[model samples]
Target chain A: MSGVEFVPLSLTPLLIGVFSAVACALPGNFLLLRRQALIGDAISHVVLPGIVVAFLVTGVVTAWPTMIGAALASLVAVVMIEAVRRLGRIEPGAAMGLTFTAMFAGGVLLLEQSDTSGVHLDVEHALYGNLEALIWLDAVGWESLLDPVALAGLPDELLRIALTLVAVGVFLWVCWRPLKLSTFDEAFAQTLGMRTSWIGLALVVVAAIAAVAAFDAVGSIIVIAMFICPPAAARLMTNRLEIQITWSVVFAVLSAVLGYILAGYGPLWLGLDNAVSAAGMIATVSGLILAACALWAPCRMRSGAPAQ
Target chain B: MTVELISDQGIAPDARHPEESPLAIRGMTVSYGQKPVVFSVDMTVQEGSMTAIIGPNGAGKSTLLKAALGIVTPLAGQAKVFGKPLRSQRHRIAYVPQRASVDWDFPTRVIDVVLMGLYRELGLLRRVRKTHLDKATSCLERVGMADFADRQIGQLSGGQQQRVFLARALAQGADLYLLDEPFAGVDAATEKAIIAVLKGLRADGKTVVAVHHDLATVHEYFDRVFLINTRKVAEGSVAEAFTPDALDRAYGGRLATAQMDRAAS
Candidate 1:
């Protein structure tokens, strides 16, 4: 076989997978920092009502309204969680569990009432995401920006990827210190004149947006997984905030691409399910990566230069 | 100590208010669950003075500090700083919690922790600029940890950890400082270094309140001591307030013996 054919027909899955991983990873760092690792799982579950409501209201499953509705719902979910904490004085984990479960149940009820039954609106797809469709969508190229030197069109997936990358880049850049300080010690951050409430809310909103964008491409489950696993792994490896973020993004992107390829072929060779379940497989891969990093990190730290 | 303020003597009636004072707690009360730990207590701390609240264990020393800083709500009382409430003047205060309170496994460096002190000053949605880094370096230098600026806080000795917190407080440059158990688990050298810095703060006209457990260092380390046991027993200069009569009143009969031993040593 020629090198070109062996280039991998599953390149689209890799692109979408990596993007989803990275998008979730940024917020994952903050979640872990704030000791809110389960928040990602909670947010994904709570966003269900928003998704179903958007579909019910519009009678269509388009991008804009679904995303906007989900974003607003995510914000509401966060507000409800905080309110519960204040009124009940309960631990955050218990509060989140309570809030997300109620919202998720409401979403299921709404879905049943609306009768928007289809492959597109399935709960499993909402939670785990559908990687196969995203890869196919990405393979078809879109119009490119006009160039004076080379007159060539760029792919639509490339354009989307570029836009998403720039958005994540700018967002992370602007909010770096506030994110770090707020994550490290929220009360201290409040003392320093930081708007701890606003920062926390903003992080939740950003995480929701990233999940929404990646949901269709990588699916919800894998996005949630990538958002959590990379940062947890990175925490085991380094003490520096900057280094942890850098390593987390690296690990996230690598896991996404590798998982895509592995899921594509592993089933046929190993007599597993033909469906492959790309989102679950990617999450499993990232989880394994975190485990491996934890196991080897102590030895690496001992042999390498001391923590600075 | 005769226990007389300038306000009481009528030399300066306004001295009682102390507008410049960083902390003013009036009728403060705190409770965990149903049991009240800190009863209604009133105190006014002058600006730029090193004041220590010394008491035996379970005397609500840390609880009082936490209530003043708004970490724990006062059931009935109000705490203010610089003539403003703690919420409004949060940026002007730096809190150095007990060294043993947090997990040492937290992933961060000494510089990172110190940088947190500057968070309020840097405001929100902005990265730490070169100016912030320079300030952090200078603060580390003040604590004689300039060489270890990049080191992880977990890798440091107990003394080093204490110094690191002091450096963080310095980086804040706040008008008020609330420290909880700063002297705990620290070596003699670390205690001396911390005291020197605190004394310098008092001289600079910044208010410092520490939750102190050692009675022996009351005279040496503090300009003023507030002996608290659930309620305010006495707050005045060390010579007058650290007397056997006041100690007995503050600690009761059981602790009076411990106080006697400390005094004898």
Candidate 2:
């Protein structure tokens, strides 16, 4: 189980981290524009019950059922929030707060009430992802990637993140104009026959898919951070939509790489003898980047050179 | 109650082009909750002319424009453009909502906002081609903000922003242009520039409908006027409908001051 192949071993965590961060950040831009950053948090909380229920119903832990279940749960969460807002005559923020809490608690209760076996789904995993344990055990260098055994040993989480990132990229590519117009000016977009409410719904659903796909490998905390910080920081740096998207992806990848390296090596370099949580550190890095942008982004700030 | 005036010079609408009347509202009743805002309003705007919708504050001046654009849901009646529904004819219509209706601080350049005018024609899944970008650039040049094409919208002054919006509507290339309060807080120069643009549109044979506030410029700027106070008070040429009696009826003693008549004169 042990080999001195340091390259492929470390590459696993970094690749997985970058893919997951990029996936979350891509859709995070729209959530930021639409002011639905909190909805990302809500879906992360709600997807847990979906996974556990999928596990119980199928008696197996696979990607397909969990994806469907999580997607459904997020939709249910949105409808429930709307209903609570309308029926209770409360504001939208209050409705989201009330709905997510109740659904999250319900998810926890559902997990406990079910007697599922052979599934690793749990609350702690949902909160803090199992990032450290995903190292490729088939130990090999880059050349060994062509080996069947090495290919098989590649963490399935990496493949999952890869597919999710691709989906995010393609959807944004196809729907760029409509999405941009709707976000900037909904009423005018409608006057142009965009069917804005429906487009708005599609945006939410796509964002939900990204959140849910990320949940299994990276958990909710990092997903939630990646969903808000990178795009926000990019916003501080650019005014164009396409450029903002690129900058956000770049920032997200930086957060993932920097966070993973520091979390793994910073403690050892300080003689603490153990790695820290990569997920928490990544979130912290994104926050630091955002804070830095707000203070010194030259496009808007007077005291610095522009970050462009 | 609905009011309809047969203008002596009003060209009879083309039958085959029943939808060709630029804008026609019939029995439009708009209410917010239990309170009625616009009640059974009926009016028709002739093509190739500038028409003003005038009313006191809270008189539903803006609401009528919104309902006609289907931006606001109407409690009763329908709005048509060029003898067809607003939905089917959306592409032929260009809307310039109030300048304050959007977040000026949004992270988009002046050119991108103008480019939005081309989105309908570009449709989904199509990139903005080089030809379209050239068109958008020309639109910006027309508004005299070509130098600020890359500038963020927030950097512009109020008058500059209004001109940018006019530039966007100009890029829309629609036959009917609907503007809501374009001159609400503009400078005198900006007002002159806007009127010049409107005149240009009229000269090009495009129809324009604006929600106007100042009574002074009504005579100079508009060929026709619709005076209302939750109802259509009168509709005719400025010389015909801008009467002291009709002004009194709509304003109800609010225009008892001498300046009111002086502004009209």
Candidate 3:
């Protein structure tokens, strides 16, 4: 509980978790309302292959190439899903299910076959991430907060997720009107010459960016959960889009902070020797919040319909 | 009842000014997959008229409107609005899609949905001003939905939902209004309110086109009628184009005898 242990061991990971949660949840609000929440799951599942492909092509486990690889993979997955939906005359859910699972299976096969013994590239690492290992080794105490030398040693994932969060926020703010109009009524937006198809594509691209970035930091469990749970729970709390968004952000932050603490300390409180997976714990907490909202939120039931 | 058979050639010649027609479609053909839903068809709406697009089920009545607005791609031909392409003249046109087209449960109020009609004027990043709010409120009032401004959209009945959509179109303040099946499922009062609003728009020199299904009210509601069955069957004033022969051709013998008698009466 001292500054020495908390600052060096917990600060960066906690910030990274919060940043990742918010980034995913912001776009998740629109996606959930638009009925495209599965796109988040699709993007996260395909990112593993993207990173593996990047390592194969560049022969390194660096950041930029892997990020680009993940982004490209998601784009390909989206296009493929659309193609299958159109050509095969299948529903979007089935197309997305078929595409992401195939790509993910391909990624696991590649990881098993490739000579990755020298690197920390495995399916488990991709799924749960290494949040516990991302410690600020150079920090001496709380004074490191203002010390340039110690701050420089902070985990790069923290900075990446923070930047992604800011980018996602700006995207939502700038395109707020068009996005809302399009999501609610695509035909109306198109009739007004709003290029609604482009707006829809842009939204999916932004969601893919958030998913890829968050997947790298908090792993796919938290990425998928954050993309749907917070926004869905917020949906039950309010009737206004603006207020719903605020509630989603509040829920995201609460889930990240509380979930991280519970994962790190709750087992110790119960006298267990070790901690649990932060990503899994965050996802579980978000699910719990959504369940509670569904059970008790005032606006949870549809108008004129009996509660099931 | 004796049925008068009008000549099949009812295509109106292109207006010399073109600007006088609020909507002009030329040889528009739309298809879904390999099956053509709407064949090469031409339609010209006189300015300041309330025209009804009537056809039987699967007759592509909605597809024609969607194709005209570029919401659905046409296989061939183009649509002009006031002598220009639809894209350049989008701001001067408004559309009210089918009531069943959107999810009413979306998290928005009635006033907010109406405000969407003014999206073009508001543009991006411009704060909604007092004038925009006033315009939306006035539109809602015109449609008799002002009382439901703060109500969630899902809380309204089917007829109220239709009225809200009309209110949104009214806020567009366009010269030409295109609506699809505005009276498909509504109470008698909502239908009366909607027709009154459409008549007001026409009296103010605004053009109105709607895909209407109720045969009994066609003569009473529309100033003109365009009959279609994959292609143009007849078009002109309701007395001229809504003849029994044209109805039989468009309905392909599917018009029940009682419905035809009601339509004639």
Per-residue error for A22 in candidate 3, Å, reads 0.8
Better of 2 and 3 by TM-score: 3
DockQ category of candidate 2: acceptable
How is the predicted docking of candidate 1 categorized under the CAPRI scheme? Answer: acceptable
How do the residues A1-308 of candidate 2 rate in per-residue lDDT, one tens digit apiece? 23356546677878888898999999899889787788888889888877777777887778788878888889999899879978888887788888788888988898888875346777888887877777887856666667887788788888888888899899898888888888878768877877887877787787888888777777888888999999999988887778889989999999998998889888999999888888888888999999999998755542211111
* Poorest stretch of ten by lDDT in candidate 2 chain A: A299-308
The candidates, ranked best first by TM-score, are: 3, 2, 1
Give the alpha-carbon lDDT of every model. 0.76, 0.83, 0.90
Which candidate leads the pack in DockQ?
3
B178-253: candidate 3 lDDT, tens digit per residue: 9999997788999999999999998888889999999889989998999999999999899899999999999887
* Sliding window of 10 residues with minimal summed lDDT for model 3 chain A: A299-308
Number of the candidate with higher TM-score, 1 or 2: 2
Report the C-alpha lDDT of model 1 over B1-265, residue by residue, as the tens digit: 1125443765432266566467878888999888788899887776556788977778889999888877776788988788886767877788888776554556778888888787666655666789999999999888888898877667788778889888999988987888888987787888888888888887776778899878777778887888888899887667767778877887887586676765654
Question: Given candidate 2, what's the lDDT at residue A62?
Answer: 82
Best by lDDT: 3
* Model 1 local distance difference test score: 0.76
